[model samples]
Target: MNTPPGLHLKIAEWMPENGEVVSAYDIAENFGITIRQSRAFLTILEKDNAIETRRGKVMPITCHNSHRRSTRTIKVISIDRDIIAQRRHHYNTYRHCPLKSINGLSRAEKWEFIIRNARRRKK
Candidate 1:
Protein backbone atom coordinates (compact mmCIF):
# COMPACT_ATOMS: atom_id res chain seq x y z
CA MET A 1 0.00 0.00 0.00
CA ASN A 2 1.15 3.53 -0.76
CA THR A 3 1.85 5.45 2.44
CA PRO A 4 2.80 9.04 3.13
CA PRO A 5 6.47 9.89 2.86
CA GLY A 6 8.20 10.09 6.28
CA LEU A 7 5.44 8.05 7.93
CA HIS A 8 7.85 5.21 8.61
CA LEU A 9 10.43 7.63 9.95
CA LYS A 10 7.93 9.19 12.31
CA ILE A 11 6.79 5.76 13.50
CA ALA A 12 10.36 4.64 14.03
CA GLU A 13 11.14 7.74 16.07
CA TRP A 14 8.05 7.44 18.21
CA MET A 15 8.04 3.72 18.92
CA PRO A 16 9.97 2.45 21.93
CA GLU A 17 12.61 -0.20 21.29
CA ASN A 18 11.69 -2.28 24.33
CA GLY A 19 8.56 -3.69 22.65
CA GLU A 20 6.27 -1.32 24.50
CA VAL A 21 2.64 -1.42 23.44
CA VAL A 22 1.16 1.54 21.57
CA SER A 23 -2.43 2.08 20.58
CA ALA A 24 -3.79 3.40 17.29
CA TYR A 25 -5.30 6.26 19.26
CA ASP A 26 -1.87 7.13 20.62
CA ILE A 27 -0.40 7.08 17.14
CA ALA A 28 -3.28 9.17 15.82
CA GLU A 29 -2.85 11.74 18.54
CA ASN A 30 0.90 11.85 18.14
CA PHE A 31 0.81 12.24 14.34
CA GLY A 32 -2.34 14.38 14.19
CA ILE A 33 -4.20 11.84 12.02
CA THR A 34 -7.60 10.22 12.34
CA ILE A 35 -7.98 7.00 14.32
CA ARG A 36 -9.05 5.15 11.15
CA GLN A 37 -5.96 6.37 9.35
CA SER A 38 -3.80 5.30 12.23
CA ARG A 39 -5.33 1.82 12.19
CA ALA A 40 -4.78 1.51 8.46
CA PHE A 41 -1.21 2.70 8.82
CA LEU A 42 -0.59 0.13 11.52
CA THR A 43 -2.01 -2.57 9.27
CA ILE A 44 0.40 -1.57 6.54
CA LEU A 45 3.29 -1.68 8.96
CA GLU A 46 2.19 -5.12 10.11
CA LYS A 47 2.09 -6.35 6.52
CA ASP A 48 5.60 -5.05 6.03
CA ASN A 49 6.81 -6.87 9.15
CA ALA A 50 7.64 -3.56 10.87
CA ILE A 51 5.40 -4.11 13.85
CA GLU A 52 3.50 -6.70 15.90
CA THR A 53 0.15 -6.25 17.60
CA ARG A 54 -1.91 -7.80 20.38
CA ARG A 55 -5.36 -7.27 21.77
CA GLY A 56 -5.28 -4.82 24.65
CA LYS A 57 -7.73 -3.70 27.32
CA VAL A 58 -9.84 -0.62 27.01
CA MET A 59 -8.14 2.61 28.01
CA PRO A 60 -9.15 6.22 28.47
CA ILE A 61 -7.63 9.16 26.61
CA THR A 62 -7.87 12.91 26.95
CA CYS A 63 -6.89 15.44 24.30
CA HIS A 64 -7.65 19.12 23.84
CA ASN A 65 -10.28 19.14 26.58
CA SER A 66 -12.05 16.15 25.00
CA HIS A 67 -12.23 12.76 26.71
CA ARG A 68 -12.75 9.32 25.21
CA ARG A 69 -12.06 5.67 25.82
CA SER A 70 -11.10 2.95 23.39
CA THR A 71 -10.57 -0.81 23.25
CA ARG A 72 -8.25 -0.79 20.24
CA THR A 73 -5.43 -3.31 20.25
CA ILE A 74 -1.89 -2.08 20.88
CA LYS A 75 0.84 -2.38 18.26
CA VAL A 76 4.49 -2.91 19.09
CA ILE A 77 6.47 -1.42 16.26
CA SER A 78 10.22 -1.78 15.74
CA ILE A 79 12.60 0.45 13.83
CA ASP A 80 13.64 -1.00 10.49
CA ARG A 81 17.31 -1.57 9.65
CA ASP A 82 17.44 1.27 7.16
CA ILE A 83 15.90 3.70 9.60
CA ILE A 84 18.32 2.64 12.33
CA ALA A 85 21.25 3.09 9.99
CA GLN A 86 19.99 6.50 8.98
CA ARG A 87 19.69 7.55 12.61
CA ARG A 88 23.18 6.34 13.38
CA HIS A 89 24.63 8.16 10.39
CA HIS A 90 22.82 11.35 11.34
CA TYR A 91 24.06 11.16 14.93
CA ASN A 92 27.59 10.51 13.83
CA THR A 93 27.53 13.33 11.30
CA TYR A 94 26.18 15.94 13.71
CA ARG A 95 27.46 14.78 17.08
CA HIS A 96 30.41 17.16 17.19
CA CYS A 97 28.73 20.41 16.22
CA PRO A 98 31.27 23.20 15.65
CA LEU A 99 29.10 25.77 17.41
CA LYS A 100 29.08 23.70 20.59
CA SER A 101 32.46 25.08 21.63
CA ILE A 102 31.48 28.72 21.32
CA ASN A 103 32.13 29.25 24.99
CA GLY A 104 31.55 32.64 26.72
CA LEU A 105 29.46 33.92 23.83
CA SER A 106 26.00 35.38 24.35
CA ARG A 107 23.14 33.96 22.35
CA ALA A 108 22.98 36.98 20.04
CA GLU A 109 26.76 36.93 19.59
CA LYS A 110 26.63 33.25 18.67
CA TRP A 111 23.88 33.89 16.15
CA GLU A 112 25.89 36.77 14.65
CA PHE A 113 28.97 34.60 14.35
CA ILE A 114 27.00 31.80 12.70
CA ILE A 115 25.33 34.16 10.27
CA ARG A 116 28.56 35.91 9.41
CA ASN A 117 30.40 32.64 8.76
CA ALA A 118 27.49 31.22 6.79
CA ARG A 119 27.43 34.31 4.56
CA ARG A 120 31.17 34.13 4.01
CA ARG A 121 30.87 30.50 2.84
CA LYS A 122 28.40 31.51 0.12
CA LYS A 123 30.98 33.66 -1.70
Candidate 2:
Protein backbone atom coordinates (compact mmCIF):
# COMPACT_ATOMS: atom_id res chain seq x y z
CA MET A 1 0.00 0.00 0.00
CA ASN A 2 1.23 3.52 -0.79
CA THR A 3 2.04 5.40 2.39
CA PRO A 4 3.81 8.63 3.20
CA PRO A 5 7.54 8.58 3.77
CA GLY A 6 8.47 7.59 7.32
CA LEU A 7 4.94 6.40 7.97
CA HIS A 8 5.92 2.92 9.05
CA LEU A 9 8.77 4.25 11.15
CA LYS A 10 6.44 6.63 12.87
CA ILE A 11 3.91 3.86 13.28
CA ALA A 12 6.52 1.66 14.86
CA GLU A 13 7.47 4.39 17.28
CA TRP A 14 3.89 5.29 18.15
CA MET A 15 2.41 1.79 18.28
CA PRO A 16 3.33 -0.78 20.85
CA GLU A 17 5.40 -3.78 19.81
CA ASN A 18 2.41 -6.04 20.50
CA GLY A 19 0.30 -3.55 18.51
CA GLU A 20 -2.61 -1.65 19.96
CA VAL A 21 -5.03 0.96 18.67
CA VAL A 22 -3.99 4.62 18.68
CA SER A 23 -5.60 8.00 18.10
CA ALA A 24 -5.28 9.56 14.65
CA TYR A 25 -5.02 13.03 16.15
CA ASP A 26 -2.19 11.94 18.42
CA ILE A 27 -0.44 10.31 15.50
CA ALA A 28 -0.86 13.41 13.38
CA GLU A 29 0.47 15.72 16.05
CA ASN A 30 3.40 13.40 16.70
CA PHE A 31 4.21 13.12 12.99
CA GLY A 32 3.81 16.86 12.39
CA ILE A 33 1.02 16.37 9.91
CA THR A 34 -2.09 18.50 9.66
CA ILE A 35 -5.34 17.00 10.87
CA ARG A 36 -6.66 16.92 7.31
CA GLN A 37 -3.62 15.03 6.11
CA SER A 38 -3.88 12.69 9.04
CA ARG A 39 -7.51 11.97 8.25
CA ALA A 40 -6.61 11.21 4.64
CA PHE A 41 -3.77 8.91 5.69
CA LEU A 42 -6.06 7.18 8.14
CA THR A 43 -8.58 6.69 5.36
CA ILE A 44 -5.90 5.01 3.29
CA LEU A 45 -5.16 2.68 6.16
CA GLU A 46 -8.85 1.95 6.65
CA LYS A 47 -9.33 1.18 2.94
CA ASP A 48 -6.67 -1.46 3.31
CA ASN A 49 -8.24 -2.58 6.60
CA ALA A 50 -4.89 -1.84 8.20
CA ILE A 51 -6.73 -0.28 11.10
CA GLU A 52 -10.21 -0.50 12.49
CA THR A 53 -11.68 2.90 13.10
CA ARG A 54 -14.08 3.66 15.91
CA ARG A 55 -15.56 6.91 17.14
CA GLY A 56 -13.20 7.31 20.03
CA LYS A 57 -9.78 8.65 20.93
CA VAL A 58 -8.31 5.20 20.39
CA MET A 59 -8.66 3.15 17.23
CA PRO A 60 -7.35 -0.37 16.77
CA ILE A 61 -4.85 -0.86 13.94
CA THR A 62 -3.80 -4.04 12.22
CA CYS A 63 -0.63 -5.44 13.62
CA HIS A 64 1.55 -8.05 11.91
CA ASN A 65 -0.63 -10.96 10.94
CA SER A 66 2.23 -13.33 11.53
CA HIS A 67 1.88 -12.73 15.24
CA ARG A 68 -1.58 -14.16 15.75
CA ARG A 69 -1.39 -14.13 19.50
CA SER A 70 -3.10 -11.22 21.26
CA THR A 71 -1.07 -9.08 23.58
CA ARG A 72 -2.37 -6.50 26.00
CA THR A 73 -0.38 -3.32 25.91
CA ILE A 74 -1.04 -0.65 28.50
CA LYS A 75 -0.77 2.97 27.46
CA VAL A 76 2.41 4.89 28.20
CA ILE A 77 0.47 7.87 29.49
CA SER A 78 -2.09 7.41 32.24
CA ILE A 79 -4.14 10.53 31.56
CA ASP A 80 -7.47 8.72 31.60
CA ARG A 81 -7.86 9.60 35.26
CA ASP A 82 -7.65 13.30 34.48
CA ILE A 83 -9.78 12.89 31.40
CA ILE A 84 -12.45 11.02 33.37
CA ALA A 85 -12.41 13.67 36.06
CA GLN A 86 -12.85 16.40 33.50
CA ARG A 87 -15.64 14.47 31.85
CA ARG A 88 -17.36 14.02 35.17
CA HIS A 89 -17.12 17.71 35.84
CA HIS A 90 -18.53 18.55 32.45
CA TYR A 91 -21.18 15.85 32.10
CA ASN A 92 -21.84 13.96 35.31
CA THR A 93 -24.15 16.05 37.45
CA TYR A 94 -25.53 13.28 39.63
CA ARG A 95 -23.80 11.66 42.56
CA HIS A 96 -21.00 9.38 41.46
CA CYS A 97 -21.51 5.73 42.32
CA PRO A 98 -18.48 3.96 43.62
CA LEU A 99 -17.28 1.03 41.59
CA LYS A 100 -17.11 -0.83 44.87
CA SER A 101 -19.41 -0.03 47.73
CA ILE A 102 -18.01 1.03 51.08
CA ASN A 103 -19.01 -2.37 52.29
CA GLY A 104 -16.62 -3.80 49.68
CA LEU A 105 -18.86 -5.59 47.23
CA SER A 106 -17.82 -8.79 45.50
CA ARG A 107 -15.53 -8.65 42.48
CA ALA A 108 -18.43 -9.36 40.15
CA GLU A 109 -20.45 -6.42 41.50
CA LYS A 110 -17.52 -4.06 41.12
CA TRP A 111 -16.77 -5.24 37.60
CA GLU A 112 -20.42 -5.09 36.65
CA PHE A 113 -20.81 -1.55 37.93
CA ILE A 114 -17.78 -0.29 36.03
CA ILE A 115 -18.83 -2.07 32.84
CA ARG A 116 -22.38 -0.81 33.04
CA ASN A 117 -21.37 2.80 33.73
CA ALA A 118 -18.65 2.84 31.10
CA ARG A 119 -21.19 1.84 28.48
CA ARG A 120 -23.36 4.79 29.49
CA ARG A 121 -20.93 7.25 27.86
CA LYS A 122 -20.56 7.82 24.15
CA LYS A 123 -17.76 6.33 22.14
Kindly list the per-residue Cα lDDT of model 1 for residues 5-52, writing each as its tens digit.
Answer: 758556755666535667777788887887778877666665654344
Error of 2 at 41 (Å): 1.4
Q: Which stretches in model 2 have alpha-carbon errors above 4 Å?
A: 1-9, 17-20, 49-123
Candidate 1 lDDT at 72 equals 53
TM-score of every prediction relative to native: 0.43, 0.31
Worst 10 residues of 1 by lDDT: 70-79
Model 1 global lDDT (CA atoms, 0 to 1): 0.64
Q: What tens-digit string does per-residue lDDT give for candidate 2 at 19-120? A: 555555556667777655665655544443333333334334465542333322222221134543465467655766665453576889877777876855
lDDT scores of the candidates, listed in order: 0.64, 0.49
RMSD of candidate 1 to true structure, Å = 12.4
In terms of TM-score, which candidate is strongest? 1
